[model samples]
Target: MDDPRSRILPLLRQGERLLWVGQPDPRVRFTGADALLVPFSILWGGFAAFWEFMVVTTAKEPFFMLWGIPFVLVGL
Candidate 1:
């Protein structure tokens, strides 16, 4: 049987179109871009690692099962 969810799911996942505007300076190059991206990547990566550790280490208990599993899964 054909599922009604097929059409509805596509629309639900579709995001609004966005245009990315670049920096105005022509002199800005790879080093400049790297400098900006590296710190953000490091910070986010550390947070993610710490978060995963908390989730996995705590998952053995009922409290972690009920709360941590879904919170980390969906990202509240």
Candidate 2:
């Protein structure tokens, strides 16, 4: 440990001790999970936006009003 009057002091209150800091593994690698989730999220968002635009412009009847509910919920 260094002197107590160090230039940059840690903000610990009384009766505190530093345990651990920083990532256990700093290395980066592609994973199977990200490969699947990324594509799924993109497709979900695209479909939601397309459905919303169609409902707003081309079709605005009573049935279409209810139809857009699913897209809005998914987009949110």
Candidate 3:
């Protein structure tokens, strides 16, 4: 009996490019399957959290004072 899967393998191999379409392969994932989404989500979330923290802290401060003056004077 001839296997169709075996015939398809040669064509797949000859393509010479990798795409996430094969089954039982090492790179395949069905959930959170996209490679770029996880890292992008993490970076975006971290920046957003830092921005919110700075805004809230500044709002609660009673007076706006020079926090970065000494370093500026020393550098010049």
Candidate 4:
């Protein structure tokens, strides 16, 4: 309980080995990659939300909605 790693180590079985452990940095910084990824992620999320909303609200047969279910679930 004192350390998070203590809880994780017990779950490994025989012959299983952990190679490396690291903590995430707390600092937030913007970079060139973010400039491209941020917009795509936003557009994807918006589309997924709109698609799901339309499926639930308007569609009757909704076979096309099946195609978008995985994309909507992953986007959110």
TM-score of 1: 0.38
Cα deviation at 69, candidate 2, in Å, is: 4.1
Best candidate, lDDT-wise? 4
* TM-score, candidate number 3: 0.35
Give per-model CA RMSD: 11.9, 6.5, 14.4, 3.1
* Tens digits of lDDT, candidate 2, 1-76: 6554452346777887666554456566657898987787778778877877887788777687677778667645
Q: lDDT of all predictions, in order shown?
A: 0.59, 0.70, 0.53, 0.80
Models sorted by lDDT, best on top: 4, 2, 1, 3
Which digits, one per residue and each the tens of the lDDT, describe model 4 over residues 6-44? 766999899987776667665857778999988988899
**Which candidate model has the greater lDDT, 3 or 4?**
4
lDDT of 4: 0.80
Across residues 1-76, which tens digit of lDDT does each residue of candidate 1 receive? Answer: 5665553555553684334433478875568778878887777666655666776686566654555444444432
In candidate 3, where is summed lDDT lowest over 10 consecutive residues? 62-71
1 or 2: which has the higher lDDT?
2
Best by TM-score: 4
Q: Write the per-residue lDDT of candidate 3 for residues 1-73, one digit (tens) a residue.
A: 6765666667765546534443586665645544676766666666655544565577555332233333333
Question: How many backbone clashes does every candidate have?
Answer: 0, 0, 0, 0
Estimate the lDDT of model 3. Answer: 0.53
User: Which residue ranges in model 1 land beyond 4 Å of their true spot?
Assistant: 1-30, 60-76
Backbone-clash count (model 1): 0
Ten contiguous residues minimizing lDDT sum, candidate 4: 19-28
